[model samples]
Target: MGISQSTLFRELRRNSSPAGKYIWFKAHDKAMERRKRSTGNATLAPN
Candidate 1:
């Protein structure tokens, strides 16, 4: 179908705290940071 359960779980696992808590706000920040990082690298790579 669409996104798989495993993919969602993997993202949650990666974004979780060291103590294994999934706080949505922190996860959102992490996701945004990751997006910016990937975008930066992609832009730089074209040079």
Candidate 2:
């Protein structure tokens, strides 16, 4: 099935904030992307 409607709403409300979830998400995404790019570059470098 899927997430219950009430549970989804509760999570949205709980996580919502003017200075919270979205900022953290963007920061985390940027960090992960930077790490992946660095790792890929290292692998492709000539020894």
Candidate 3:
């Protein structure tokens, strides 16, 4: 069976907030940088 819209919303609400504010922002920035590096093929190119 498929998940209901309300259930999905509730799940998103549950995990969206982080307890540590600094850690949350730091993690978000790190994740974005990691995505950019991976998608830009930085590892494949020579330094």
Candidate 4:
């Protein structure tokens, strides 16, 4: 955690559910999905 408290809070806020509960699996899925979309691949490696 080199990040500041506010940065951590912002990430949690972004990945948290609309109902305002944090589910670990859902958050991980959301992150992976976003990663895929942003990189155009399932992982970070280039084609």
Candidate 5:
């Protein structure tokens, strides 16, 4: 809740339901899915 207003607005736009409603559980699931997808794209380079 300490996030900036712009950050909050961005998340709301990103995780809002199809009906344009914001639900905590749905938003959390969406965020988790996005995090998982992003992490999957990270690859470590061999030293």
Candidate 6:
């Protein structure tokens, strides 16, 4: 909710269903999947 409106719009557009409906569970899953894929190296690297 602290995100900018444009960012919120972009995320909804990216993760929403085919019907253009936003689902929390589906969106969260999609975000987690993307993070998992994109953070592979980051997760392995030492902080």
Give a tens-digit lDDT track for model 6, residues 1-47.
79899998898899999999999999999988988888465455678
TM match of model 2 to true structure = 0.35
- Mind giving the per-residue lDDT tens digits that candidate 5 earns over 1-47? 89999998998898899999999999999888888878465678999
Which residue window of length 10 is worst by lDDT in model 1?
38-47
Query: Relative to the unseen true structure, what is the Cα RMSD of model 1?
Result: 3.9
TM-score of each: 0.64, 0.35, 0.35, 0.67, 0.67, 0.66
- Report residue 19 deviation for candidate 6 (angstroms): 1.1
Model 6 misplaced stretches (Cα beyond 4 Å) = 39-47
- Candidates 1 and 4 compared: the better one by TM-score is 4
All models: lDDT? 0.87, 0.63, 0.61, 0.88, 0.89, 0.89
lDDT measured at residue 45 in model 3 versus the true structure, 0 to 100: 62
- Best-to-worst TM-score order: 4, 5, 6, 1, 2, 3
Tens-place lDDT digits, model 2, residues 1-47: 39899986665555556554545575566668877878463345678
Backbone clash tally (model 6) = 0
lDDT digits (tens) for residues 1-47 of candidate 1:
48999998998899899999999999999989988878453334564
lDDT of 6 at 33: 90
Q: Per-residue CA lDDT of candidate 3, range 1-47, in tens?
A: 39999986655554455752344566567667877878563466678
Best by TM-score: 4
- Looking at model 6, the pairs that clash are none
